[model samples]
Every structure is written in structure tokens, then in C-alpha cells.
Target: MSTFQERYAASVMNTFGPPKLVLVKGEGAHVWDVDGNEYVDLLGGIAVNALGHGHPALVEAVSAQLQTLGHVSNFFTTPQQVELAEKLLELIGADAGGGKVFFTNSGTEANEAAFKLTRRTGRTHVVVAEQSFHGRTMGALALTSKEAYRAPFEPLPGDVTFVPFGDVDALAAAVTDRTAAILLEPIQGEAGVNVLPDGFLATARAIADEHGALLWLDEVQSGMGRTGEWFAHLPSGVTPDVVTVAKGLGGGFPIGACIALGPAGELLQPGNHGTTFGGNPVACAAALAVIRTIEEQDLLEHVSVLGQKLRDGLVADPRVTEVRGEGLLIGLDLAEERSAEVAAAALKSGFIINNATPQRIRLAPPLVLTDDDAKAFLAAWPAILDEAF
Candidate 1:
């Protein structure tokens, strides 16, 4: 092992196993390791590096904002904070004019804030989906359905139920008038990039409306142009009561937000929630740069076009059983459970991917990933699989 890897193992916790590489530099869709080897970063920090690494806009924004006003207590708000909230609300939807935003340092905190806000509705029950991933925090973990993740952290905040994903009937049956909210991911990221069944979100919106329960969508992994849209649910024409976004929101700057729409916006009053660095100027500035870059460079359209190309090229391989998801967020199933081997092979061949499941490989490349980079990966797809399988 390299010295950095050895040091990391000795210093860092084993929650994520061990380090993959001691990356030292990055530019756009590429990165270099400590060994001076280069790679195409297909994971994009698990869909967070919207603007990619060392983006001039992101660097400049963070630098300028830090120089201007690094941080202040929530007692005083900064222009970047308010501007970011407004911009996020606008991107989610125009009807979000009355939407309220609560910023946090990460996706978990965003979900935690939303979880607490649900309790303010005077209801205790929350309906969630099976195989969903919210966060590792206690409140978010309770909302998540994985037994492995929840078992170790027992006695989590109670009154949360999970139903089979894509099964509207099970979801409706699980929800009731006592339900304070129904939390869901527009696209299940950690569960192998599983997209919800057709009209499943519409069904969720209907169910929430039937019981007067708040509908919350966790866009932590799929938002911020990852799915070729601002928010995945926007295409369905279903407006959620609460939307939690992180990951790519700051383009790797570490910021998140829990946005509440309509009357749900008034659920969390002042003093009910607090965060010291939730909307720090530097983070907000970085987020603004990402948003501006996406718009100015038209990365959304690029993601849509390039995603189709990649998906088509990938499925052309007979070894691929099926491909799921949209835009840069893609997952492919193999004919056999060789995902780990495939990931290893990809790394050896100067590419980065994720083994989201035993038989599944996921890719969430940077939105700024160039056409040539994507095309090169596709051209190498057959060789990579052949070498792996």
C-alpha cells in the first residue's frame, strides 16, 4: 500500500472499508492518483461533482465568497444564502414561490431536518419505500428500509413503515390519516439506480393527498442535472410537499437543503430547527456557480444526449442483461454476478465505476464529462467486460 493509504487506514474509520486510490489532482471528468495514473471519473463523487473537479467557476465562487464573508451565526443571513434558496425554489418549480428552504451541511442533515419538520404536523406516522436510501443519520436511517442499516442502530425514531417500491397498492394501504408524510426517492440510487415504476410518483402524490400527508422526495443522488432535469419528479407533473437535495447541489462543496412547498413550508418555524453553517456563504457561492455553469454551458441537454448514447452503446453488449435509469445516473445488470471484478477491471483500464450490487454496475459521470471521454468509455466497454468476465 502507498504511504497515504496506510496512513488513511490507521487514521480513518472502516465504515467504507478501505480507500480505493489516493487521488491527487482532477480536471473536468478526469483525475490522477498518487501513482500518477489518470482515470475517467465515471462516479463523479457519487453524483456530486456536477461541475467536475477544479472547475474554474466553482473555485472562483468559493474563493470570492470565502474572502468576502466566510461564515456567521444564523443570527445574520448572507445574500448568497437567500439567493441560493430562491434559485433552488425556482428550479424545483415556478409554483415554489412560497416554498421555504432550510439549509444543512450534507444530505443526511437535510433529511434529518425534513424528518423533524414532519413531526410538527402533529402526526407521527411516516410511510417509506423498501430498498430506499435516505441517509445514515438516525432519523434518516429510520425512514430508510434496509434491515442491515437499521438493525445495528436500533430504537430509531419510530412510527415509520416501509412498503414494496413501485407497488402503489402497498403504499396506499400503508398510508393513513395519521401519516405525517410519505418519503420517497424519485430514483433509488443506492439500490442499483432503480427508477420508480411508471406513474409511481403520481400514485404517491395521490396517496399523500388522500390522507393529507406531506409528500417528500429525496433527490440527494439524482438531482442537480444528474437525471438531465433539475428534479426527477418535475417531468411527472407531480409537485412534492417537501424536497431534499444534496450531493451535486454544491458541485462537491458539501451543502444540502430541505425545501418545503405550500403550507408545508410553514411547518418548521424559527427555533424548531437550527444549523450553524447550513447556508455558509462559501457553500452557497459554490452552489450558485454550479447552477450558473449548468445553465450557461447547457449541460442538461448534453447529459440527455450523451446519456442516450452511452446507454445504447452499453446495452449493445450481450453480457448486459438490462440497463436502468436516465441521464448520467445509469445502472446496468450483468448476465452474472461479476460486478466487483468488472469494477476492478475498469479501474485497471483507467476508468471509475461503482458496483452498486452484486450483479449491477452504476455510472454517474460528471455532467461536464466530454463527448470524447464518454465515447472512449463506450468504445472500451466490450474489452472491459471481456477482460472481466
Candidate 2:
């Protein structure tokens, strides 16, 4: 019989290369492959599984909502949808007013919605940061700065200028009267969790305001308490006109939202955007449960404590050269460009992690990751590095 790997290669697109392992089931931060080998899930489905696997709250909310009202088209709205939006606004400290939400089924779509909203500013040009990642969709792709991802897809919705990330001077030079928005990721996740320099976001906000451009932060991978805060930009105290979020919003249930604040919230009129499955009751219910669970369990505070422990542990090893990030969204540089080998070694030792770049390893475990799991990984860190080297 053909193995799952063989079948996967034959039927699926080669975008992500071969599958790492045939995962069959999961509970909390642990997952079992088809061979029944258990592993700690440190990557958390690339930061999408905020609640980890089969959290009771998430499962119950999705199941109950499905049974009650599975979906409703854009022509109508559901209480779950409205309630989830309100909850997000409140969580982000946008409750003061002038905040509105547009839901999507994925991060890319959330960006697409925000992209269109920016266009309504009567300016077509957008300033994006180099080494940034927005999404794969055409519009989001246009704002993304990686040449490899954008080169082949060129002629993408044009008028975007790429500036050096975390460089306030470069950003100031880029925005002009024709610029509609200045897009940035609170932390560039796909580019190995790169954090901005001190005061960079606040500078971007100021520059955007000076040029009448919207400050659009793509928090798709850094939002939803990943940085031990509701949003990574919150600590900077800079309020972005547009914030796009996903990855952790539904705790693995697949949901995204584009929130526009103040006058920017009014840019997208009724006919400007719509989605068929964006804010369906089931997805909204899932998101609501994830948010409520985080609050009720005080996971953010737990994440802050555990993250410091894990970061300190990882950096304690000589094999790790540099550690950067906040809370559970962490990135580390290895002594050598052997991140893939390290990831493989980690998997062999019953762990799951991600190599976002040749020399960078990113850890975005579920907020529910236990102390024991983290300690285990730390205890095995030396061995894992030795094996990889």
C-alpha cells in the first residue's frame, strides 16, 4: 500500500515540499503521528493553534455553534458574529469607539480586505517594509517585501515601495502624498520572527500621520496575545489606523479580521467588500471561545512567565547565538546554519518546531504549553543540538 507521504506527493501541490510526519491526533501541546509516536508541538500549527489541540472550550464552542447555526451568508448577520467582533474590539482596547471589523476566513483574506480599505483613501501607493510578509493573495502579496515571493508574481497590484524595516528614516522617505498606507508586521513571523527596532512602530505612526497615510499593521502572526499582549503594537502605545489579524484568532479554527479605527473605519462602505464564509457563526463562535478561554484562564500572564523561562533556557545553550522576541513568539539564531537539521533532530526526539530560515528557529507553541513540556525540551536542548551538529 502506498504510504501517506507517497499519496500526498502524488495529489497535493509541491508548495510546502514533503510532509514532515503524518500527524494523526493531538491533545493540548502533544501530538501523535500515524506511527503512534508522541511529540510536543512547539510550533502550534505555525502559530495558528493558540489553544493547542482539542481544547474543551474551543471544541465545545465549535460543536455547539455548528449544531445551532453553522453558517449565515453576508446578506445576514448572527449574534456570534457581532459578539465576536465586539469582544475583539474590547480586547484590543478599541472600545472607546470608531472601530469596525471585517471578517475573513484566513489571514490573506483579512489583508485583502484591509488592502481594499486602504485603496479607498484615494491613494494607490503603499509603503511596505523589506523582509516583511503579508500573505500570498495578490493584494497582500503586493505589500509583501520578499523578492522571492513577489518576483514571480510581479505586476502585482503596483505602487508599493519597500523600505528597510525598523529604519525610521527609510520609512519617512518612502511615504508621500500618494501613499495610502504604511504596512508593517509587529513582528515579521515568516522572516524568522524579526522584531522591529526600538521606537520604530511609533515612528511609522508619526510618519503616516504626517503624510496622511494610514498606519496599517499586519498583526496576522503577532496578535491575539502571542506577545503576552492583546497586540504587539500595544506596548508601543501607537494606535494603527488598520490592524489585520489571524493565525491565532480562532485557535486553529481558521478566522481573520481587519479592524479599522477612527475615520479609517468608515472607508470601507457596504458595497466595498464582502465574504461568504468570513464571519460565519461557527468561525465566530470558535474565535469567541478562544478569546474567552484566554481571558478566563489568564493565559497571557502564564505565557509571559513561561516564555521568559523558555527563552532563558534556549539562550543558555552555547549552540544558540541570539534570542529575540517577546512572550511565546520567539526566534533564535543557531551557531550554524543547520536549522533544518536541528528541526529534524528535534522531531526525532519527540518535538515539533519550525526552521523559518536556514539559521533561525522559531518557537510559537500553544499558550497552553505546560511547564513540564517546556522543561523537557530544555533538558533535551543540548542533546538536540549535539545531534544536529
Candidate 3:
């Protein structure tokens, strides 16, 4: 093992098993390891690096904000904080509809805050989908449906029901007057980028309305132009009562938000939930810069065009049985359960990818990934598969 790897094993928690590489530097959609090995960052820090590595806008914003006013208590608010909240509302189309935002440092914290917001409705039951991944927090874990993640954390905050994903009938049957909220990810990124079936969101909206349950969409991994839109659920035209956003929100900075729309916005009385470093000026400024860059660079359109090309190119290989997801949040299933091998092969070929499952490979490259880099990956893909299979 290398010096850093040995040090990481000794000092860092072994939660992620082992370190893949000791990355030393990054720029654009590429990174360099300690040994000076260059690689295309196809994973993009699991969809968090929207503007890609070492983005000037994100760096400048965070640096400038830190120099100006780094940290502030929730008792006070800054221009950056207020502006980011407003911008999120505008992007989510909740500006005129009356919405409120509670900031957090990560997607898990945002989900935790949203979970508490649901309890304020005086209902403990929340209906979620099978194969959903909310977060690792106890409350968020309860909302997440994976047994592997929840088994050890038993006796979690209860009354969360898991229904078959994209099944309108199962959703309607699962939710009742006791249901506080219905949580789902439009595109299940962690579960190999599973897209929701057509009309599912609209039906979910109707069901939530019928039961007076808040419809909360977890946009943590799929939001912020990752899916060619501001949010993955936007195309459905189903305005959810709550939306959780993070990941690409701050480009590569740590930031997340729990946005409640309409009357649900007022559900959480001030003291019910809070965070210390959630809405700090630096993080807010970073997020604003990310949003601004996405707009100025016309990244949404770029993501759409490039994503389609990637999807088409990936499915061209017979070894790839199926492809899923939207924009840059892509997933493909191999003819065999060789996803791990494929990921290793990709890394060997100077690319980074993820194995969401034994058969599923997920790719969430930076929104600013250059066409040249993509072409190179496409050219290498067939060989990568050959090595894996």
C-alpha cells in the first residue's frame, strides 16, 4: 500500500472498505492521483461535482465569501443565504406559491430535517418506495427501504411503509390519513438510476392530496440539472409539497436544503429543527456560484445533448443489456454480474465509474464534462467491457 493508503487505513474509519486512489489534484472533468496517473472522473464525486473539479466560479465564490464573512449563527442571516434560498425557490417554481427552506450540510441532514417537518403534521406514517435510499441518519434510514442499510439500525423512527416503486395502486393502498408524507426519488440514483414510470408522480400527487399527506421528492442526487432539468420531477408537472436538494447544488461544496412548498412550508415551527453550519455564508455563496455557472454555461442544455449521446453510445454494446436514467445520471446493466469488474476495468483504463449493483454500472460525470473526454470514454468503453467480461 502507498503511504497515504496506509495512513488512511490506520486513521480513517473503514466505512467505505478501502481507498481506490490517493487523488492529489483535479481540474475540469479530470483528476490526477498521487502517482501522477490521470483519469476522467466519470463518477463526479457521485453527482456532487456539477461544475467539475477546480471550477473557478465555485472556488472564487467560496473564497470570497470566507474572506468577507465566513460563519454566522442562525440567529442572523446573510445576503448569500437569503439569495440562495430565493434562487432555489425560483428554480423549483415555488417562489409565488409560498415556500420555506431549511439548509443543511449534506443530503442526509436535509432529509433528516424534512423527516422532522413531517412529524409536525401530527402524523408519523410515511410511505416510501422499494429500493429507495434516503440517507444513513436514523430518521432518513427509516424512510429508506433497503434492508441491508436498515437491518442493523432496527427500532428506527417507525411507520414508514415501502411500496413497490412506480406502482400507483400500491402507493394509494399504502398511504392513509395517518400518513404524514410520501417520499420518493424521481430517479433512484443509488439503486442504479431507476426512473419512475410515466404518470407515477401525478398519481402520487393525487394520492397525497386525497390523504392530506405531504409529497416529498428527494432530489439530493438527481436535482440541480443532473437530469437535464432543474429537478428530475419537473417534467411530470407534479408540484411536490417538499423537495430536498443537495449534491450538485454547491458544485463540489457541502450543502443541502429542505424546501417545503405551499402551506406545508409553515409546518415546522422554528425550534422544531435547526443546524449550526447549514446556511453559513460560504456554503451559500458556493451554491449560488454553482447555480450561476450552470445558467451561464448553459449546462442544462449541454447535459441533455451529451447525456443522450452517452446513453445511445452505451447501449450500442451488446454486453450492455439495458440503460437507464436521464441527462448525465446514467446507469447500464451488463449481460452478466460483472459491474465491479467493469468499474475496475474502467479505472484501469483511466476512467472512474461506479457499480451500483452486481449487474448495474452507474455514471454521473460532471455537468461540465467536455465532449472530448466523453468521446475518449466512449472509445474506451468497448475495451473496458471486453476486459471486464
Candidate 1 per-residue lDDT, tens place, 1-389, comes to: 99998999999998998888999999999999999999999999999999889999999999988888999979999999999999999998846467999999999999999999999999999999899999999999998888999999899999999998888889989999999999999899999998998899998999899999999999999998999999988899998999999999999999999999999899998789999999998999999999999999999999999999999999999999999888999999999999999999999999999999899999999999998999999988888999989
Q: Estimate each model's TM-score.
A: 0.99, 0.98, 0.99
Residue 252 alpha-carbon offset, candidate 3, angstroms: 1.2
Candidate whose lDDT is highest:
3
lDDT at position 363, candidate 2: 96
Model 2, span 1-389: residue lDDT tens: 23999999999999998888998999999999898999999999989999999999999999998888897698999999889888888877885676999999999999999999999999999999888989999988998887899889888999999988888888898899889999999899998889998898888888888889999999999999898998999999898999999999999998999999889989999888988899999999999999999999999999899999999999998989999888999999999999999999999999999999999999999999999999999999899999999
RMSD in Å for model 3: 0.7
Off by over 4 Å in 3: none
Which regions of candidate 2 are displaced past 4 Å?
none
Q: Model 1, residue 388: what's the lDDT?
A: 89
Clashes of each: 0, 0, 0
lDDT of 3 by residue, 158-219 (tens): 88889998988899899999999999999999999999999999999999999999999999
Error of 1 at 234 (Å): 0.5
Q: Better model by lDDT, 2 or 3? A: 3
* TM-score ranking, high to low: 3, 1, 2
